[model samples]
Target: MTENLPFIEITDIIQSLANKRSTGTLELSRDGEPTTYLFFREGMIQHLKAPRSQVILGKALYQLNLIDEADYELTLSDYAQTGRRYGEVLAELGLVSEEGLRQALSFQAREDLQNVLTWKQVQTRFHGSSQPLSDVFSESDLEFELQMGGMSLLMEAARREDEWSLVREHIPHEDDVLRLSAPGAIKAEDLEVRITLLIDGYRSAYEIADAAPCNTLECLHQLAELVREGKLVTLEPLELIELGHEAELDDDHEKALKLYQLARSRGQDGFDLRRRIARAHHMLGHKQEALERWLEVAERCAEAERADLAIATLKEVIELYPTDLHLRQRLVPLLVANAAKADAALQLRNLIALAETNGESPQLLTDLMNQLLELDPSDRPTLKALATLHREEGDGVLAMGRLDELATLEVEADRLEEAILAYREILEIDPENLNARLRLAESYAGLGSTDDAVAEYRGLADILYNSGLIANSINWPFLIRVYESIVELEPSSTPAWEWLAKAYIENNQRDLAISRYLGMAQSLRPTPGEPPSPALISPLARVVELDPTRLEVCYELAHTYLALEMRVEAGRTLRQLAEEALRQEDVPKARSAYQEAIEIDPFDLVSRRGMAALHELQGDLDLAFGIWLLCAELCQRVGLLSEGRSDARRALAISASDPRALKVSAALEALAEEPQAAAALLLRYAEIMHERENSGLALEAIAQARRLDPARVARHPLLSLLSTGNTPRSGAPLR
Candidate 1:
């Protein structure tokens, strides 16, 4: 095992680099843990990369309240599209000021450094670069590099560690709860109100630290101080025990053990508590004391007539002590008496092995094997022994039954060759056993013996057909070849023909697929006003796939896809059909196609846009406006705000002077929570109305803008002209 080095040694390594003014990347790694990378430039720590634990800049900004959810999501979307750094994206989006970013970056660095200082046994390597960091890192990565003095950071870390050590006695664990000694008692000497308000006797120190706006280290230190001053206290031992029980129930044995130990040290003790402690130990690793305690508990449970609980306790002990012969010997009879014969047989087998290892007599071996086989017939050793015994006695029929069981087990274990030999033996004894023959065929298929499997399946298929049960036997994949033979033998069999065509499709021989269906379609053309033949669905779809000019076939394929509940495929088919309809100047057909496409896949942008266009061409401006606005809202929801804006612009273009259109455009901007953008669009609408000398509409637009941003509306240049009932002197736009 690698021993932990002193923390001072790590600080010294970093300090020596600062003293030498070295520039490089220092990588720290530990066994089975993620590596940490620290970048230095002219002796200053510029960046730290810990893939496992680094706090991303965007998350830091959000945690610090420097950016809200809407802005953060938009920044992520913009960053993903542009491949830019998060800090750059935040600044580009104008969501965070320079100072705010600086603070967030510093917070990120401090949090990462705190994590680094906790590692004491990491192997370190420094790759020195002759080139400056500006050249070494990409511009995007270097643009927001943190400028932290290495020695100063080390000193600060050391100071925090020292303070934490002083407070460790009171706040030894993050989950240690703190409550006010007297409720409503204010201790304002040095504590922040946020910290005091969070001391509601429920939240742990880590939770309080997370809930507060301040750094974790500072919040923890304040909480520790409160405990030291006797103004706060930890949870009582009983309460701690309750928490440990809760942790145990949650399957967190490690945490539960720690809490239990802490409670024990605080003078909590009882027989039931000791039993719980023993169970926790057993669940964790089955220590010697835990085994002994559980054995004692099992005896007491038996004395109390709790057979189920006693059996469960003994089973737990046996799982950890599988080789303890006495334990299994004791457990087998109990399991048998409890009507758990399967479990009893398993334990009895273990006992037999222990007896053999101890040089006990083999006199009971046959009887034990017989009993085990009665409970689990698939037990390989017992089945093998019985088969050998029956063969030695010349009882071939009884021997074949044991062989059958062994063959099933071998097949389940994927020992197909062994299973095949056993099945061949069984067939020799009973040549007409169709079940064995079917199993042999399936085994051949499983082993990739396709030709052999096909021969067997074909024979079985012929027999089943003569027996009038072929329909029930053609479901296996290997039977597809049987269907092929049937199609050749009976050319007039429609079901056989259909099955062969489907098999051809599955095999990707699409050119050969649906041939019979195409023949049927050709033979039976639908008369006028009569429903099309159902068999034509496949052929029509195939025709549309081959030739896009088959408009009627395309419509039939769309209906077929819908009937099968394949809506996505149906929507795509309809969209293509709509595009073709538009090319043919069939406006009504195009509109119906687009409408069907939208109904199937309401979020499909292409169909919605096509439908909106059709509505516009048909002189239904109101219907067109609703679809365009819906498209904008959908785009915004998917982080395509720019596309959403374009959609909103399309809506505005439909009816520029419509008040509802202007308000709808403003609402799209509000989706991004940008009141400024929303108010600007409203103001732009007001300006356009004033230029048209429409005072009433212009005032209405100004009133809507005021609702979004009163200050911007109050200071607008056109506000005075519209209020005084005069057109703007110049039509210059208000930005």
Candidate 2:
């Protein structure tokens, strides 16, 4: 048995003992906290005791609401006065029955075990003893012993820990206070409701968790859920400070600053406030603002005893005035006083960079580099600055040597790739350096051996997807190569196939992607009771998007949909195929496709259009005209005037005297600025009306033609005699 808990987990220890059917006591301790003891009898947890008073069986009963507060107080008093076990005291006082006491003890033991499992930083020791913990358990208590399965406890603890990690993000600080936003509107289960009712604006989340009837983690999890559901809200720490007692304002500079920030946001402004704000900023490591604000009151920050602030302010000011050596000279003492050696070195390096930018003298830059190296002898930035200085002085050999040293340092710091790139730079200068080539190859192999290229490509894909560039034609070639590589390396990879299919669709290779997906689906043999894989559905859908005219793809898609018992989707795909067939003027195919579509969805428009188109193609003129008229009316009713006009034209081409067709065609012709065409159509309408013995309507149609084109109507033989109430002779050419 392991005596100490260093790297070993408590769960592992418990599970090992249970597997071996060992009998002993396990003790766990943390510094300044009382030790927890667990007694096992033949691998089962016979009893457990938590050091915390909250885990006592009597307290657990009170928390669980199995006993009232008065009963709990009496039980505690009797146990204290008689030195009897708490469960015995509860049974003797009749506060709880033997069965209720047993249940409470079991609950208490589970809570203790859960708490013990979370003690990752604590010390644990196990002692193998022949004697049972007779001191802790009486004979009657042994009869109702709380036996917990170690494996179940371990699993529950692990689940709770995972849940706690998510919950902690929302309720990050224990000091965070939450208040009920809408007490009346919170509709939750009994446990959540109980936790919600405990939430008051004054209590911290930790307090609410402690006061709830469940374990602390369970209470917090419910609280986080309530917050997400908008039934509760967390109060900011600054807001809590205002709601707190007045004495909280003194001594704590951080809290005072928060209060002042709140005040400023509320429109409180003055010079005193600014000074206080500046002082707070200085004390809180906001170095730049402290100096600027102090300079407004005192000419120099040194007068305010904040030399660090002065140095930071000078750095900021020097960025704007790089040639100001006096300011740099003033910053030196403050930098030394503040122990800012690296920052001092950085300031000198900045001056050197500025001198290079302004094309200053090399001697001046050399003096700056020497001063920088004096402050921090191994400053890489200053060393690089010196290297630049040497290279500008036409010292190529010295510059290359400096770069070699820097690369060696990078390698020692475990930046192998950066070192390799530096070596490549040397080869760029020399070109025949075999050592540089070997090192670069070694670095490349090292990175490739990690097998993170797939992950890197996945990350790149994510970036492109987020940036809305994943579907860009320019990125398609690179994305295709990445996805193909992943699939080639990991042949059974589903995500790779999905990404590759997407790339194919975006790159206009939909048919190829569809074929690949169908092959993939054929390879998968689904379980007897399960649906087909979603991977099969994606590529089929992409094919339809690419070209809905592909009846073969539609057939495969519909079959796949039917295999998944998705009748509605299957019907939709069939309708797409039927519409595409109708568009291609394949009458027999359209008729067959429409029959199938109508069987799936009787009211679908695709089937209606297919049937109408089939009738028209078969030359059943009257029946076709009637179906076209119905289609026109449907289109017109749905505000599709262009489609309505097309249908009406089709009907008129089949039968010249179709009433709806003539009316729609005449109107469309007038809108198209063809007044003579309109006049001719209305004259034909009049002839049709005249044949039906509707003389009044025939005269009305003639009047409409005259209004459309008076000159054309006068020239028309049938329409010219409209005012005389005379019809044209039989077999007269209206044209």
Q: Give the C-alpha miss distance for residue 640 in model 1, angstroms.
A: 98
What does candidate 1 score in Cα RMSD to the true structure?
32.1
The numbered model that scores best in TM-score is 1
Global lDDT of each candidate: 0.75, 0.68
Score every model by TM-score: 0.38, 0.33
lDDT of 1: 0.75
Model 2, 200-258: lDDT tens digits are 67666877888776667778887887777777787754555464323134555554555
TM-score of 2: 0.33
Q: Which portions of model 1 show Cα errors greater than 4 Å?
A: 1-8, 52-95, 131-140, 187-190, 244-311, 314-344, 348-735
Model 2: ten consecutive residues of lowest lDDT: 449-458
lDDT of 1 by residue, 1-735 (tens): 112333346678788889988888877777767877778888998876666545667768877889876787887887789888788888877889999998887888778877787776768777787443443345544556788888898888889889788668788877777788887555577587867888876567877886665667767887888788888888887887888888899998876776776777778765456567778887788587677776677776777777787788778778777777667766766787788998898787787677667765444554566667877877887777666666666777887888889899999999998888777777777665677777887788778776666666666776687778765544346556676677667655656666566546545576566564454345444577665555656666665665676677688778767766778878988998999999999888889999888888879998999988888888898899888888987886787777788888898898776655566667778766778889988887777777776667778878877888899988897887777755545565543
